[model samples]
Target: MAIRDVRAYIEEHGLVETADEESEKSIWRKSGFEGVRSFGEMEQILSRFIREHRDARRLNRAQVGIMVGLHETIFARYERAFSKLHVTRLIHLCEILDCSPIEVVHAAAPHLFGDNRKEADDKMKLILCILDMPALTAASLLAMIEGLVGERERSGD
Candidate 1:
């Protein structure tokens, strides 16, 4: 069975939470996400991306549906988050939208895609730009900093 079906079974059987107000939910909650909640969130993000790209491209629902081999009603439901889209359909959507899967992923959950490292690297570049230093000078400065750090480590400081 699909993960959604499993989630539905668990919920229907009261495995996640009790009907009583005093009872808390399951032990499976993490970062505000349960299995079914994750699916819903993904659907929302994907639907928004598809709609935005389709509108920006000035493509109508019928056009996208024909391009992706889906009926217009189904495509409309997909955009409205009334249906789940498979991975293959998502790839087809990306191709029709003229966007890459990486772009969609970065848009959907940027936090999961090395965004902190990218932001830090960008800040470092900004700092270098503000300093107005040449590339060679920046390289030399980084080397000096590394050397100093190594020396301090070796001296147990």
Candidate 2:
């Protein structure tokens, strides 16, 4: 169904406040993201991440488009931020590029992953290191982390 139809259905069912009752600006302010990057800026960042991943894989836009079952021009629109990249489409594109959605999100908004930019970068580096490790070594690291988490939970941390 079209977005408008879905919206209308939701409003009709009182699932959410109508736009008339809650403006977009109010919603944004209420969401506590007023000073964060704008949607357009985030979109551009995500688009750049997509392009970089494609380049790193040495694959052209057309090749990625074919793999993701989108027309090259349509995919280009996403890269140009002319069209919004839906989450499902992002996941599909990440799959085609042999990358994870979390990686793309972290690239776009590292601040979401940690208390500060440096912390986020360090976490990303550690995650990349783990990803590059041998399977057994990674498994051992996971076990250690799980044990630490269990201990923390036991202490009500």
| lDDT at 111, model 2 | 68
Q: Worst lDDT window (10 residues) for model 2?
A: 26-35
Model 1, position 30: C-alpha lDDT score: 20
Query: Tens-digit lDDT track for model 2 on 88-137?
Result: 99999888888878888887778666767788889888887887899999
List ranges where model 1 is wrong by over 4 Å.
1-37, 115-157
> Residue-pair clashes per candidate, as listed?
0, 0
Candidate 1 structure lDDT: 0.71
TM-score of model 2 vs. true structure: 0.71
How well does each candidate superpose onto the true structure, as a TM-score? 0.52, 0.71
